[model samples]
Target chain A: MGIVNVKKDNFEDVVLKSKEKVLVDFNADWCGPCRMLRPILDEIASERSNVKIVSINIDDEEDLAMKYGVSSIPCLVLFDGGKEVNRSVGLIPKDAVIEFIGE
Target chain B: MYDIIIVGAGPSGLTAAIYGRRANKKVLVLEALSYGGQIINTLKIENYPAAPNISGFDFATTLYNQVKDLGTDIKFEKVIEIKDGIEKEVITTKGSYKSKTIILATGCENRKLGIDREEELIGRGVSYCATCDGGFYKDKDVAVVGGGNTALEDALYLCDVANKVYLIHRRDEFRGEEGLVDKLKEKNNIEFVYNSNVTKLNGDDKLSSVIVTDKEGNDKEIMISGLFIAVGKIPENENFRKLINLDDSGYIIAPENCHTNVEGIFVCGDARVKEVRQLVTAASDGAISATEAIRYINERK
Candidate 1:
């Protein structure tokens, strides 16, 4: 499992500037379901260092939520050059993320 | 000049073509751009009967192809203006196209954010339709600003799709449907904040969060990933402002089915006032307008 921690401070540089693919996991710890999905994302991040994985706490970073129109939790946006290319919502199996990245 | 010319290629326009061509009329569909109007932006449509989960883009494409199969002619040109009289003509950027009957199906565009960076993130993080992009935000937090029935309804819909939903309003009260508000409060995932205004969006790439100030002039930051703005939608009736009769909210007014004040002109879809503006209803309106236009053409010619 390869997962990298993405903070609010370095969200842009990691998601937009990185040569590798970027995946943003919009979530918070308080959410019970979010907890179930966090580890899945973490594993994907570690397995694939080429992609940047970031977990966001909606409680502290409301700005990011509104920017992407993240009306739902567990929204994962796959980006390749700062531009959003693909996205998935709700909780699914860890294999789903792996299938998405295809590393 | 064709026997029937319908403006707009959305559900209404394409549906009209299906009926008009079946009536043996020379149906000419003059679309402003490619086939499929704003419906292409929609992600999913559950309310459409028999179609458990049809996407807006796919459904639009299918509808367009269906019209084509019926031998309805299509043109990719934007119609600028229309002149109504004993002879009806539509003015486009290239040249004018005249027809005995015209069915106006030009739909409405969503009211803009009017903010600086809001336009930059239209499809990136900023969106208007939940059925289209809701799945992309599974365990993420999102905020919705507005105080109408649509706003509250959006908050409720997002609750099932999104992780957290923040309901923000500029006024102390909300003006949504009574039953919907009661239904929204029952959900534990929703957070209601009153007298709050969204001042700015803060994020370099996608969206990190938003900066909002409460009524008391206190600043607070709400962190979330998706933002759904259900404030209000503006009708695109500027081109037809002088051509037809409009309601108070600037929507085209049809008397009964698709009949306008003009002799050979008709309208359908979101541009006209109706109870619902779903794909089915738009298609229904298109059919009605085409029938009306075909009959009028037969009588006039």
Candidate 2:
């Protein structure tokens, strides 16, 4: 479908596993770079459901962040089978993400 | 009508007022508590470029005087709520007030321990701010919880006065900068206990000790005269909840220019979500909000 708003309630089911690879973007609405990076993420998510793009707001689920060892944003983590396989911190080009998912 | 009204008079609010007033806007600042907000409790602020060594209280006083000299209208009263109209308005606990545009610079409050007796024991012994109360524990043993930048910074600040400081954290590694970790370790008075959480506070009328649970689920009591909880903070967005679109963390959703969903309403500082929650960054947000607020007010006119 589309990007699912991940919360403490459903973080496990969505980010953990699905038929497709998941890319989780941990960001805050007030962050300037997060705004700049939003459209790129939306574009990528719209193109490929094989790669689910989920944005996590640390302010909402601080405990989930503590569990994930996230100290900074915008942090992008890739998950498969309930485990984080890769992660990148700060903002990057959309092409970089496209390459990340091997698209 | 005034061009802008900035709520809260902390660094962000004051700085925003300065820019707004300088931009030729008739600005009024509404403050609930004392003007400086949390800065009054700060002992020293070495980071705000140019002034290498300045007490937060003194620096804030200087800012206060500067804004006042510029003829900024300041009202010392709590803002109960904000009414968003064609032009946003802010109502105080005292009376009703209106503005052409409003900037929300209200900062965050320290998160409480949430444990029983913590509130009753507050001021008696338990505290969240080290700079505010660390002086009382001079030459005595004290405890600081959390591993964030604030926690580490407070622990380091307490190291100067307290004879011994016990820095407790649930993680072995700190979430703060590496340089700070090294600095705190150099202090002979600082001792670190990793993979542990604060369970409870054991105290009498004045001050006493604390109970901590290790990662292994073992809990133990340690004798101490003071306890400081620097774990973290939650944004003070409850007041403006109905007026703005706050994300899950209760932080107001301000765009890149600090403009919220409602017209003529802007949010800055700790009340909004941000990647870096440093003092300098908050000051920058204030500056940005002012420039953008001018443009916003002008566009509507």
Which DockQ values do the candidates obtain, in the order shown? 0.04, 0.01
Task: State the lDDT of candidate 1 residue by residue for B228-280, as single tens digits.
Answer: 77787777778888979999988899955889888788999888888777778
lDDT of 1 at B39: 63
**lDDT over C-alpha atoms for residue B286 of model 2:** 92
Fnat for the candidates in order: 0.02, 0.00
Q: Cα miss at B75, model 2 (Å)?
A: 0.5
lDDT string, candidate 2, A2-36, tens digits: 66779998887887856578888887654434544
Each candidate's chain B TM-score? 0.84, 0.91
Q: Write the per-residue lDDT of candidate 2 for residues B3-92, one digit (tens) a residue.
A: 898888888888899899888899999886556666655557777789877776567778889999999999877888999877667888
Task: Score candidate 1 by DockQ.
Answer: 0.04
What candidate 2 gets wrong by more than 4 Å, as runs, is A1-103, B186-190
TM-score of chain A of 1: 0.86
